[model samples]
Target: MNDFLELVKSRQSDRTYDTTRAVEPEKLERILEAARLAPSACNAQPWKFVVVTDKELSNKVGKATSGLGMNKFAKDAPVHILVVEESANITSLLGGKVKNKHFPLIDLGIAAAHITLAAESEGLGSCILGWFDEKEIKSLTGIPASKRLVLVITIGYSAKAKRQKMRKEKAKVISYNKY
Candidate 1:
């Protein structure tokens, strides 16, 4: 996947992973670097990435993500990047208030995208998980209760094959100048 569009097409939510393998430190560092370089409104960079690699702790965090028959595969993933929302800079705060938009959340979303894409480029599969026990995870990670954990990204060598993407047609989603 040298081409960017092809890379985008190939990336998917990988639910099954090869648990025996561990993500290399170099590759993980590059992925984190990509997230660090993600753009933010007013360059606030209002987020923190908690990279979880320890087997014992990862299992606990993964267990917290599983409940109500959802995200059971998270426990098998070798790496989990916990995205913690942080305070935004003054400029981003004022701009968001004036525009009636929450820029930090949006900024964090962009960072998540960067992380997943970088993981793909490193030949690793990733899944962005929004459903999890936030309180339990916070306690495990020792994160402040006040801060919000926005996303938990699982990354590892995928055990499942790539499936065709099901999406709406471009004609239905795109427009020239008018709605």
Candidate 2:
């Protein structure tokens, strides 16, 4: 398999992480660099990443997560990544007429894909979390009204590297020529 392909296959969602095993600065930098390179609409690139490394802050934010599993699972990871996208930044590029749905969230999703793959390549583990209240998250992060939080991610080295996640046989999902 190609290196990139292997990286993709190797990635898995690990709910358990080793808080004692801190991710190196260089590794984190590479992950951030990868996310920074993801493409955006008209280069609007309205996303901003706020990494919470402070344990107290991480736990505080974790508590705001609505899912019981999320609150319990969050503390084990060493860092939390807040994925935020600003509507104002997007509106500038989109111009008149704020559509029923804005595209910054989509753009943020693209960047998040980059981040997850990058973390895998760096031998780090991550869980993409999204069970938190928007208002609570905004208040916790002191984020502006224009910026909406799209997702949160807990990142660090996993307690154990579980085997690869098996997908449904590709034949079932793939279509030839047309679906």
Candidate 3:
């Protein structure tokens, strides 16, 4: 695969991580660095990533996230990057009139995408978890009241070899502009 395509192709949801394996500090820093560089609306940069690598902390986060559909595999992953979205950045950028519904979460999505792809590049694995009790997460992680929890990204090294899951063929997803 070409470099870009390889980056895209390499990414997958890895839930079963080897408890013995871990992301080196330097590689983890590089991945977060990539996330830090993601583009944002008016450069609001309203996203905060709280990484949980400590087993006790992971359990706390996992306990707080247990009900979400995405949390199944997520609990096992060694670290969970809690993504918080703040409206203040965009609001401040726009000079006070808060026009939401499009800015906060969107900026967070961009950051999460960047983080995921960066992890893949480093031979690390990640899963974007979407379900969890927001209030519990905030309390568990000590996330402030002003920021909203957007996603819980589970990150760790893959315990097994890489393989493709059965998926719909690309021909079905591509379409002409008129279609």
Candidate 4:
């Protein structure tokens, strides 16, 4: 998986994980560092990664992510990285207002991509989860209610095999000049 395109092709939203294994601290730290170095608009970096590694706490946070038959596998993952949305710097805020686009959300999305990709490079599986009991998770993690919890990323050894990716034809998705 040294090639960047191959790495992108190999990365998937792994649903099942090997419960007995734990992610190495060094690997996790490197993954966080990758995320920390993710580029942001105006270098605001308006996000915080709240890592949950303790068994009981991770399980609790995972449970908060499960309901309606979604993210049931989250509870089994060994680690959860909670993506907390923070306020952007004044320049980024003004730029976002001027452009009518929320840059922090985009910045956080890039950070999440770095996190999952770094996990994949480290031979770990990761899933970015958006559906969860935000208030409950915020309370569980001691995050202020005023702040938004954007995403929860689960990381661990994958138990499932990779499936061939299905995508639209290149012609349908790619264009030469204009739409």
Better of 2 and 4 by TM-score: 4
What root-mean-square deviation over C-alphas does model 1 reach? 1.1
lDDT tens digits, residues 1-179, model 3? 49978888778888778777767888889988998999887778887889888887787787677763546656667788999876546455564345535665677888999989999998889888887888888887789877788899888888877788677877787777855
Instruction: Please provide, for model 1 over 15-122, each residue's C-alpha lDDT reduced to its tens digit, 9 standing for 90 to 100.
Output: 999999999999999999999999999999999999999998998899999999999999999999999999999999999999999999999999999999999999
Query: What are the per-residue Cα lDDT tens digits for candidate 4 across 1-179?
Result: 35988899999999999999999999999999999999999999999999999999999999999999999999999999999989999999999999999999999999999999999999999999999999999999899999999999999999999889888999999998898
Clashes of each: 0, 0, 0, 0
Model 2 scores a C-alpha lDDT of 0.79
Q: Which residue runs does candidate 1 get wrong by more than 4 Å?
A: none
Q: Rank the candidates by lDDT, best first.
A: 4, 1, 3, 2
Error of 2 at 24 (Å): 1.7
Worst 10 residues of 3 by lDDT: 91-100
Better of 1 and 3 by lDDT: 1
Better of 2 and 3 by TM-score: 2
Query: What's the residue-level lDDT of 103 in candidate 2?
Result: 63
Query: In candidate 2, which residue ranges exceed 4 Å CA deviation?
Result: 66-68, 88-101
TM-score of each: 0.98, 0.86, 0.85, 0.98
Model 3 lDDT at residue 99: 58
Residue-level error in angstroms, candidate 4, position 106: 0.4
